[model samples]
Target: MAEISGVVERIWRYPVKSTGGERLDTVEVDGRGLAGDRLYAVRDGSGRLGSGKNTRRFRRMDGLLRLGSRLGPRLGAPQLLDPLGSPVEDADAFLRAYLEREDVALAREDAVPHFDQLPVSVLTTATLDWVRAAVPAAVVDERRFRPNILLRTPAGTPPFVEDTWFGREGRVRGGVRLAFVRSSERCAMTGLAQPGLPHAPEILRAITLAHDGRLDALATVARPGRLRVGDAMALA
Candidate 1:
């Protein structure tokens, strides 16, 4: 196996699925993934979870990105916050009003995983640069991809460098080991409008034309431990 190394540039956790997430300086990685990541989501009466697309388990629910979730003073207790960062008094009522559908309500993941594919999503700075190079007119932001871990590779590193980490086990300086399963497939959600980003379908179009619509790595925790923004990552 080849050796690959870099520094953890950023860590993000989405308390609720398909919504804006909170960036952390440090986090705990357990068997499932980053603590408090995608444990809850807006579910409809038909049992389909709110998502950017319609699937057997997910329903196309617009405006989910307009909301944000924050971890309480302690982890595990996640609260849904409005875009402005105010706690919503009534989650169901707020969701109903925001989504404009009475059948929509907030729900937690049980029995099944709430993640789109894998528990953890990893994106590297080089990949973002690749996207920017492909679509220079569009805003290339990490939030558009919503990765749990953002790695900053050394200068002059080639784009999509994470592809080499696929099917490999990586150890972080903080002791978290992850097995990169596969490259994550990009979806329409990447083009959806977020707080600081506009609705840019060109980004997804460019990805589809250049990279078959895949942009990041999806992995699972191989060993539970801690991770921080400045931690070093080594892949074997």
Candidate 2:
């Protein structure tokens, strides 16, 4: 029998890399990840991936974090939205203006997945609460971490419990199974300001000094299926 550890609280999917993602009531998981997650990314003129973490080309650019991407009615087509939720007709142009770079272009991921670490990442509310307690004044919304699934663990559960999930197999209510691969490493991107959230460098520093620079768990899809908010999660 599997132990019930938590329930799905939210589902998020990033249509474009390094951009604000959409909050979904439900999402489909596959080998790569959530259906349209990280399908597209902004690339530099030299063909390097434009990532907030890739300081070389992006120069630690945080503007990408302010942009959001949503899937249009048609599949595989993502519409770019600004921080204020306004649609951008020419996404590349708007991104160029926002980043103040002329060499950047929006491009789709080919062959391999565009995820920085694993296909799927999960974080628990306990960890968020713990981090918030560490830095009381800082905003610690899960958006800063950009996880695909946010699980609400039972009350009084310890923080960073996801770390212990490594090597364990878990099943969602819809029969979707996942194998926790490893603890997700923290990056500078977490310190960048996004939309209404103010920049909080202390959050990353606390994670580094106390949590070993990791806060969440990365997982691989063992069984492709749909997952919805409020779904029960069981681990064996």
Candidate 3:
């Protein structure tokens, strides 16, 4: 193993894809990813999944972000909440009302994975600080990037340090092994306004101009274990 590159700063899990997620202090990890992350997603009429960008399998339904979801009973069934922070009586109806789309419904992942790319997305505080410096007026919050693991680089570390981890192996202190697959590509979702942040198109613009539209690094769990906040990450 290599020297400690950083410490885990924050952990997040999105029970429902494309919606607000819940922060965690500790979580289980497996080959799939953080337990229950993006396990469910809103499916459109044509069987397209809801997301921040339009792709062959995903539709750009930004309104889905207005809703929030957390794991309910069964550990995978997500309980959708309204913008006012109240649990919705009917998830599909609530989604229809908020999104104004008649054919959308909440659904779980089937044979296909719900993640945009790799299962685990990792971001670092150093990169966030760099974005803040690049766009001083924008609210460059970590929530905007929606990373599953937020690593806090040591003081004075340069931004995008995680970039070097791609194609390498690493392990978290708690025994979770990972392979940094590739750099996560940024999309319009980073600029979309969510609960505590405002819509700032410039945020995406700055990333595009400076980083070629990529921000975080994507990884896949190589060994199943547990991860806790404050755990150290060592590249191998």
The candidate that achieves the highest lDDT relative to the unseen native structure: 3
| Lowest-sum lDDT 10-residue window in model 2 | 53-62
Report the lDDT tens digits of candidate 1 across residue range 1-236. Answer: 53657889999999889989999999989998998899888999999999999999999889889889978646665788887778898888999988889998877779998998999988989889888888888887899999998899888988887788888988887889999989888899999998878899999898898878888888989999999998888888
Q: What TM-score would candidate 3 get against the native?
A: 0.96
Q: Candidate 1, which segments miss by more than 4 Å at Cα?
A: 1-4
RMSD over all Cα atoms, model 3: 1.2
lDDT comparing candidate 2 with the true structure: 0.87
Model 1, C-alpha of 122: deviation from truth (Å): 0.9
Name the lDDT value of residue 183 in candidate 2.
81
In model 3, the worst 10-residue window by lDDT is 69-78
Tens-digit lDDT string for candidate 2 (1-236): 79998999999999988999999998878877789898988888776776777644343556888889998545467899998989999998988999889998788888756777788999999998998899999987899899999999999999999978999988988879989999878888888989888989999999999988998889999999999999989998
Q: Please give each candidate's TM-score.
A: 0.96, 0.95, 0.96
**CA lDDT of every candidate:** 0.88, 0.87, 0.88
User: For model 3, how does the per-residue alpha-carbon lDDT over 1-236 read when each residue is reduced to its tens digit?
Assistant: 48788899999999999899988899999889999999999999899998888889999886778788888535857889887778999899988878889999988888999988899998999999999999899877898999999999999988988889988877887899889988878888888988878899999999999989999889998999999999999988
